[model samples]
Target: MAETDAAPSIALPPRQTDGWQMLAAIERVLEAERDQLALWVPVGFGAGIAGWFALPGPTGWIGLGIAAAGVGLAALLFGGTSRLGRAVTIFALAMLLGLVAIWTKADWVAAPRIDRPKVVALTGIVEAAEPRPATATIRLLIAPDTGNGLPPRVRINVDAEDLPAPPPAGSRVAVRARLLPPAPPMVPGGYDFARVAWFERIGATGRALDPPVIVAPDGGSSLADIRTRLTAHIEASIKDAGEGGIAASFVTGDQGGIPEDDNEALRRAGLAHLLSVSGLHVTAVVGAVMLLTIRLLALSRRLALHAPLPLIAAGAGALAGIGYTLLTGSEVPTVRSCIAALLVLGGIALGREAITLRLVAAGALIVLVFWPEALAGPSFQLSFAAIAALVAFHEHPKVAAFAARRDEGIVLGGARILLMLLASGVVIEAALSPIALFHFHKAGLYGAAANIVAIPLTTFVVMPAEAIALALDLVGLGAPIWWLVGKALGLLLWIAHVVADAPGSVANLPSMPRGAFALMATGGLWIVLWRTRLRRWGVVPLAMGAIWSLLTPPPDILVTGDGRHVAVRDGRDGIAILRDRAGDYVRDVLGEASGVEGEAPALELMPFARCSADLCAVDVSGGGRTIRLLATRSRDFVDIRAMTRACAAADIVVSDRRLPRTCHPRWLKADAPFLRSTGGLAIRIGSGEVESVAEQVGLHPWGSFAAGSR
Candidate 1:
């Protein structure tokens, strides 16, 4: 009876909310925006390529097969069924395509492995010549020479003082040299020089024992000849080596000519991007050409009325981009920029949007498909990050609001542009900071400020001036233009010096973990790609990455790949480097990783250490852990005996020579055999644990070949 009276009011738990509704909302949004979201295909494909590279050895092939099968199954199950099904299918297909791309590129660029170091007479045609401030390096494409088992390409370093002139590109040369496989990372979790070499088809690096003898005169293609002549002319035009080097770099992308100190200055000031041939350079050149073409077409009434002006202008821009790419030697960055420029021009020619996310995606996809290995390189990462960030930021509502304001006058308009430049620079620096940290272990704190001043000057003055000068030089009328370029370069150099000299211009940070970087990158991409308020979620991963990077523990000891240098972390968070001789590269890598600037002093090189002629003993205490380390540079029996005596009481022993059998348990041999296998070793003193570069990277074909042999 009571229930009958109240059959009325059964509330059913007030219709409790379910988590599935939120997911349903997401699905609805994704379905409605499938076309816009499809841009992620190339991104996912690139990620899959990176994954393939990260996989261990032949397991990559297995992973590829699995992905391909999954894609096929997905397509079979959901072909044209629903939006969600299509999205899943697209994802699987993209991953499969990525793996296929990686496999194809790897196979296409594969070179014969070098088994051992050998002194041989090498005869090959020089592909390129990069003259460093301290040495001259020639890139030689082997001509199936008989004596040595050199790979397709080798980089040979000749003493600059002894060899006054480097062999020009396309010149056949003969040289006596000791050829070794490309050097691996200097420390665990460091740069992978071997991987870079593999992708570049450079199988080995060598030091020339004698000056190269030119077997034939330069016989390069017309494009190469022109580029060489242009570079030579620019270098000869400017008297100062630094200025000339900067001019050449801007025009031809030959950075090797710049001095190390100058390069460091640029890096510290965050102007190093200007040295690379990238989107900025290509855009400047293409824009100038397009503007000129449009103006010329406008002058002709018939052409303006009847002809497709935009198409003609776009064609001119495309030609300019092609020329610039060829001038820059078609480096990866240049190629990427050229592709993007061409895509944008093609869109203009077709009456579509000139610049859009699709254009960027297409360019990225092309690079990924052709050179999947570039996904690992800093230049590729930084270039894409900068452009993507710029595009995303400019497309944002806030940026649009700022840009919509009418130009009051030249003064106000200039101010607005300056503000926009500052904003864009900030956005780019923020986007690239994680990548730079992950790769270089450092960030330029004042990058935004430096870029604000540098970008406008470089884009409007330096690049355009250089391009004009290049054109004029073909007609022997480039002297004045060259002077103008030199002036702009001088100003750029001055800006670099001034900015880099500022206190705290460079921020040295320990390397960020790969997982943390991946997390941050995902969030960054989300923020850039998503068109909803949910994009704010990206901040969470970004903050988490920053915290993770700050908290990452620095290695207690860093051993160089060559086994000749060891950096031990001291109690004061300082580094004590133990070495028979100084190595700037090793010092810089260790310093950046440990957050130390410049070089560790001689006293700090082996603090609290007792050293004999060949052996050095040190006790390192830090983070509530003590480690007894004994290092010896000599393989002499006397030094070995001293090392053995010390090893009995030591927790770790690093030696250039093999240790005695008694010391085997605690020994980390830095000999050729040990380094060949391990590349480099980073030891955690407290746990007596080790991280090997070779082991962490696993047994890839390229790295394994070098690691397997002495």
Candidate 2:
């Protein structure tokens, strides 16, 4: 009989009590995996801060400091063989210190205001277009030229000099700009200009001193002008292609041409990423090249051996990808994504059929080294997280089943492709959700569904049309292709618009508290760095969610005015007030936990979410259900009783005048509840009656509309 090899002796610790065993297991992890896991974290942390570092000022210093600390921590953790325990403790301590510094530095917000009276000539590049078309402003990328630092760099925005039309891209010009903060209440419902601009490293904004002048090089080359022309051409090409066309967008990051309505539809359908060229776009181009190269080389073995067809194709495709990134202004996400793809391609060229985490790590190290400040931008954070998640997920057994088995055919049917896209979207969305929610207060719930439908269409139809359009334009026959692209774009736009308008579309979530957000982010990082395994530790976020739910309190006071209803903070927290009267919008700010059983709960649980008193005419009764109310003819009772269905009591008793009415509730007595002041009207509460609180403050309405029956 052939001798059978017995299973290798299992290295087993003697059986012990559950508690001791658990502690031993954890200790083993601390000894074995903790140091390694901690080492990778700095890279993740560094990537997140890279873009911000490039912005100049204390931000750069903070980034540098974090990086230094991280490296030191990694060194201590991984350097010596005998000091592992000490190394782990030191690394943890360093992380705590570094995070505090990073967090404090990021909270340093600048208030940028223009000084038209002291206008000075400045130079910079156009970051993006202002919503208004009257003119555009250029944000300088130099540090001395901006809000902080004295090294001849800064991000000052100069209004474009008045010209017949916009200057072509890359034209360097001098302009006098009086930097100013965006006027308060800048947009109807949008981002805070100052905060967002802060992240972009822009300090002040003003106007051009002269018509943008073209600056020439020592010899005569004005590469900026050439770049300008190309950018404009790309923009126009996409615009001409109609709405939602990714072809022109792929060449330039000007997907705004896709129309917001159409974009929303596509977003709802889960296909909006097609609008931006990212890892998927680079991969698509690479896949196409690989397919073509394999087919072409199969015809002749000599070509493969003598010409090295695979290498040539990979090189060409990579060059194309890099060129694409450059043509599109080399956005942080695209650049990072391109670098990663190239690393993978470079691996392919090396004759290794398998690519590894080492490749991704190399790519990240390269990017962080180059743009240390990029880590501040959402793009870099989300992009890197998505990439890491995909890599980890791909390495897992179940997730691999979802990944493309062969380069030749990932999936065929549109629905199947859609599902894969959805899965990827969900993975990324889930990975980035906490931060996105914390910072943006917006969540794309159906994003996965949207990507499912959109990515395939984009890969197969939209992206190819753009490449074809470019060639056609070169050959002087681009109009037909442009037209075809435009038509398809319109369809995608329509789809996007429809989706955006769907019953449950944009989830305008409430702002996340700092601590909770920190917890969520930490949990997510744990999941991302957890080596493709669903460890029991993954339940940390769910535990947090449960805690958040249990701890959340009800709103303190419900105030209504000018057809508006808002929940006032009743705890030790800073208030982030919404713009207006949409109860749904206000409800979103209170957060989703408030909304239970398809309606906000009427619980007086936690101290934070609780409200003070039933106040205002908007709705104290029936949970202020409907959002409709006619403009106040007078501040007297506005009759929303039918809507509130709070047969017990009305939303609030309104009184425009100081006089009392027998019809008004005895508690509501002709109270002067609304008073006009410089900051605006003060709607007081905490009275036995809704309008009574204002009466106690001696604020009387100057009219006779105070009666509930007015």
Q: What is the C-alpha lDDT of each candidate?
A: 0.77, 0.49
Q: Write the per-residue lDDT of candidate 2 for residues 619-698, one digit (tens) a residue.
A: 22223332211112233453455313422243233333342333333232222343211101222233222321122112
Best by lDDT: 1
The Cα RMSD in angstroms, rounded to one decimal, for candidate 1 relative to the true structure is: 3.9
TM-score of 1: 0.91
Against the correct fold, how does model 2 do in TM-score? 0.62
**Predicted candidate 1 versus true structure: per-residue lDDT over 1-710, tens digit per residue:** 34455456656665535755765676787866665687788887887787777666666667665876686576659554656567767777787788788878877888875666888888877776666652355434445364555687888777776555555557778889888877677776688888888878888787889977875464445565566556667888877778888888878887767778788889888889988989888899899999999998899999989998888888899998998899889999999999999998888777787777778888988998888888888998899888888888888888888877794999988899888988888899898888888888887878898888788889888777877877887898988988888887888888899889999887777656777887888888878877667678888988887888787777787777666788877667678787635778777888876767755654235548877767677887655787677777656676456555677777677766666666642545455567667777777766666777876567665776255422
